[model samples]
Target: MVSPMLSMNQATIKHADLRQTLDTLTQTGYHSVGLWREPVEAIGVPEAVRMVSDSGLCVSSMCRGGFFTMPEGPERRAAIDDNRRLIEETSAFGCTVLVLVVGGLPQGSKDLAEARSRVAEALAELEADALAAGVTLAIEPLHPMYCTDRACVSTLDEALDIAAPFNPKAVGVVVDTFHVFWDPNVLRSIARAGREGRIAAYQVCDYRTPLEADPLLSRHYPGEGVIDFKALTQAVAATGWHGDIECEIFNRAVWDTPFDEVSRHVADAFDKYVAPYWPAE
Candidate 1:
């Protein structure tokens, strides 16, 4: 059974030092954290690993990998090699999954379908490396608004379709409420993921305000938003998913605040807005 835990994704506390964030999170009773490569590399991977270990914090997942849609050439090959390094780092930190954000359209290219295919090819190459490392590679389907620049895998179904070739190993989908709550087929997708053993992670957050055409700006705390979180949780629970339910909010307003306060707010919001739905059954 996967114990319910929290990870301090870089989204919440942007300006604070990574070590300080980990320390504070540990002090606050969060047993796990998400390590961002940018900050981790800055601090040195070995030292970063040691710091997390010394603090007794488990890393739930590494920040990112798999942006193959850019220059499908030498640049893309370099990304694959870099992802191998990320897998090694995740292993060192005792993380369960290496999160992947499949890239979007290339510069001046409106060919989204081609970008999606590029991601599929890249994942096929990375799948073996990830499985060999005993680490799952979780493809997070970003909100549709980010389709142009973030991730072409913009839905759970799409991700599962791409992950079809890597079953029973570690290629899977990440269900983030903010990205998927509005999806017409979310319930079926979650159940399908469960059936296929492809739920690498499930993230819970809400979209409070009515969405603008821009999907990036549409995110809210679990209950404060319009997401039918009850239905979402019911679907996830139905699949017997005991994995970490991450709270990944990328709100600009939240990131600009104090770290301590954001943690408190996020934790409180989890309890008040998100946790009630995931009752232990």
Candidate 2:
């Protein structure tokens, strides 16, 4: 079997410095890393690019550039402009995919359909710029739990529908195990995304029980929780996806561990639970 390239998402080691994270990833044999926009921006895009490039590691994807559900006003316009800048940054880093966590309802509003509609409109507005920048806008469907605040796009199918009107090269879907594993139709959605050629990124992380108060940080490493990594990995492989499988956990416990040790654990988990499902050579 030919294992997919493994990538470490910056969120996995949120407490570590970007340079230290990159260094640890390289030392642990990760071929690439997924960067978070906040940290990358904190270091300045050019320097962040230089740091990763100097480490000889490729960027798998940039963690987010979407939040268009706000009320139309300066805030909304600013969000779009910020996303455009994020697209440029992704291009500057030579990364092809920029993950988008399309925002949920505007404050004091509960109309999900409206929020979803706004997301579609936002994608249309950014599609041309995404193409121009050579960056694919990867719509990440966060778990239903995040539907009220983080992302209204809560399933791969919903994300695909949002990307349907645009060229796959300009818009695609992110298949994140931690978020989509609970979906009854996820397997079908994966197949559909593959057939449509809109699977831009595949992120792997387990879902823990007794969810954290801030569920956003509830992600666990592969095989550490209830996620059936074997099944999910096989499903992704069945789609003929050959992209990097990023390990992006947000657990505070994992973050507290030493970055080097965390890197080793991530590599071992990928080899154990994920690599076995790789398509045969």
Candidate 3:
């Protein structure tokens, strides 16, 4: 049986559409699913919701909805507006969390600090909208390698600092293992996030050496790499935060495989490396 605490994120099967993603999860006995906007939008929200409901799977947050690192301009305004629409879509799914990927420095910009300030500014602009929609913006800190082009916030501590000024319910952080496993202060940061009640989501994925040419595709199944899942999951559980544990893989090999095989692999890996560490009911 699939662990009741497990939810397979849609991004693991990047090639699958809404229906295929849901089917793969259910076929493998997963109890929930994490969504991605592109696939969800491709099928339209109403139909996507209907299909998710039909699958009888608990839905997690949208994969992402933040990239407002640009200095104030038409582009920044447009990003905020698009995120507002994403918030509405998240609410439609009845999920309380909407993940944010605070964008990196704009082209021709050498000042990383200024770019991060823009992330803070963008959060301020959207905090009220997120609150009004009853959705929490979960800020995801990608690995430092991605700081220049994907996400500027590369540590949980930094993500939390950026979120500190905003209401915790309206803005929060994602403790994704792949990005944070390398942080020496990660344990301290996890404890702090729990104390602050700011862990919007907990995601599990392993990282290995010889990263792909596109490093973003370097994610591996739990235990397939060197991360200490037991340590992190135990720390997250220590907070009395019992939410679905999402397996969100981004490896090209995993995606290139058939969805059914990928789902089974995720289930096996999650059960072996993650579920055992999760707190028991």
Candidate 4:
């Protein structure tokens, strides 16, 4: 089997001109992308689709659409419906997965368990629509720090449990290095993801020290920090996976840099850190 290719998450270079961002990726030799929702809306999906397709870049996954942990009512329904639309948009782009962040606290609420329940309820409602659209919803477990405001599902174990009821091919987990590296159970969780056939997407970024001084600046490029990425890569590949190894970074400093340079830097770092682990026959 061929090695998994590198993919650029648009948010990493989101500060750049949209068209130029796509062009920069193509010029830097990346053929896959992971896009955030805001830019798609800003540029209009039809035109964005055209830009990606014309440039010969495949969208590996759409960045978001799953903040269902908020207060229930029209707002919650709207979130679910919006996800359905996102799935339709994913279908239009011929992308496979819609990355679900699962959401955090709602308004004045601070109950983590309640927030998680909302995510479960939302998934139960949205799964069928995703299956119909042939779009997989990859539940991304954000780090524990993000638990209060980003995602209640902050570990691979919890993510897998939530995804257990659905068809693995339809609803799955997005293994992001930044989030799972801190989990002592990550290796076992990854093995379980492979065993249960639920590893929908796999990404890697290095971890920072101090872990809290600057939250946004915590993520490092592959091989730049303490993550045992080689082991993580092996665990992911043990699943017999053949897909893009997406680079999903969310560093404020990195974002401030020119978008084109960030794209090239991501591609180069991926090549240096994860490329060698691809099976060599």
Q: Give the poorly placed runs of model 3, Cα more than 4 Å off.
A: none
Lowest-scoring 10 consecutive residues by lDDT in candidate 3?
238-247
Candidate 4's C-alpha lDDT? 0.84
TM-score of each: 0.92, 0.97, 0.98, 0.94
Q: Between candidates 2 and 4, which one is better according to TM-score?
A: 2
Lowest lDDT sum, 10 consecutive residues, model 2, at 1-10
Predicted model with the maximum lDDT:
3
Q: Put the candidates in TM-score order, highest first.
A: 3, 2, 4, 1
lDDT of 4 by residue, 166-279 (tens): 888778999998889879999999999989988888887889787646685678778778888888888888778778888877777788887767877787777778887777
For each candidate, what is the lDDT? 0.78, 0.89, 0.91, 0.84
lDDT per residue for candidate 2 within 1-281, as digits (tens), equals: 11348888888999877888888887777788899988888889889888888998899999888999987899999999999999999999899999998998899999998999988888889999999999999999999999999899899999988889999999999999999999999999999999999999999989978998888889988988898888888888898878888989998889899998888888888888888787767
User: Candidate 2 — which pairs collide?
Assistant: none
**What clash count goes with each model?**
2, 0, 0, 0
Worst 10 residues of 1 by lDDT: 1-10
lDDT per residue for candidate 3 within 116-232, as digits (tens), equals 899899889899999999999999999999999989999999999999999999999999999999999999999999999899999999999988998889999999899999999
In TM-score terms, candidate 4 sits at 0.94
Whole-structure CA lDDT of model 2: 0.89
Residue 243 accuracy (lDDT) in model 4: 83
